[model samples]
Target: MTKLYTICFLLLIMAFGFLTDAAASESSFVDEIKNTNERFDTRAVPLARQVTEESVLAMEEYQGGSFRVLARKKSIERYRCSRCHTGKPVTAAQGLELTHGNIALAHGTEGPGLTCIDCHHAQERDYLEDKKGRKIDFDHSYQLCGQCHFRQKRDWLGGAHGKRVSNWAGERVVYNCTSCHNPHSPRFAKRFPATYSVPLD
Candidate 1:
């Protein structure tokens, strides 16, 4: 029985040794294949050269404002409101401050008691918050506005409302609600047309 046990132990040890050797061989084989592929890739593809000032200028010359449409978010000088209001929490009592005192809330005749946080996200100052508390990007702010003003949203989508940028023949890039109408005071301010000179003799 002792002799049998000794033989079984010896067989087990041999099996473990074989497995370890096989694993090591497999790992080495994989590593070799990886190294070979890496070497081939390196040789096949040339390293990209650093873009110089002259190259940049040349590229800029070729690139025109043909396809690119001007986004209103880019025009906003003070976009990130949280930069100043980082520590400050938005409150109703905090009325109109010195920073945004001039903002007239003349959007809806009955749309009173509306605060900044009503549209703007509390956590994300850059994004607008929907009724469902979903973060809407400043670029796609129309989505947030669409929640209440579904008619205008549909009109804008159907190319009825809002001004379309550049050529109307190709890609249609229209201005957002915030572009024409201020988020705080969405009503288009009453502006009188310039008087025309009489051409009668």
Candidate 2:
């Protein structure tokens, strides 16, 4: 009977000790909650302000000084277009398809349909020519696009349209228009909404 009492008493003491420790922990946690204003200052947190080298491709100056843009000519498959172009006119014979037969020209609107030679330089296959016959580098193709899309160009220059590849607090690396939109089509394809609606019975 004494052994049973001793075991029961020890168990009760242990339970009380555990409860006390738990209560003390809760009390400390509550005290911590009460002292919330004395916590570490958010302003002291370090921020990533510098843009990494990989984040930039090429930098150009606009009205707001220098900004970065993704390189266009670097991304092209057959970049230095002079390889097979040969600067000769492509006159197709009966049943003879041109080399770039895959490129379906869907760029312009109502008119006598725009041919490849209209935008591309006839004599210089490596360059795109403006309406004034000035040579435009593939990297600066935005100049050609801006000839018609002046409004969007204006917005792009003003940082209203287009996107910046850099984060909130780094070098301003703006994306070229061709980054998001296809130069040939430019129209964004219709995509399904992210949130699926509940099925109505």
What would the per-residue lDDT of candidate 2 be over residues 134-196, giving only the tens digit for each residue?
Answer: 997776677787888889988887788986765655567777777787776677778998899
Residue-pair clashes per candidate: 0, 0
Report the Cα lDDT for residue 37, model 1.
Answer: 44
What lDDT does candidate 1 reach at residue 94? 57
* Superposed model 2: Cα runs more than 4 Å off: 1-61, 88-99, 196-201
Clashing pairs in 2: none
Residue 46, candidate 1: how far off, in angstroms? 39
Models, CA RMSD each: 24.3, 7.4
Worst 10 residues of 2 by lDDT: 51-60
lDDT of 2 at 29: 100
Give TM-scores for every candidate, taking all chains together and pairing residue i with residue i. 0.55, 0.64
The C-alpha local distance difference test score for the whole of candidate 2 amounts to 0.74
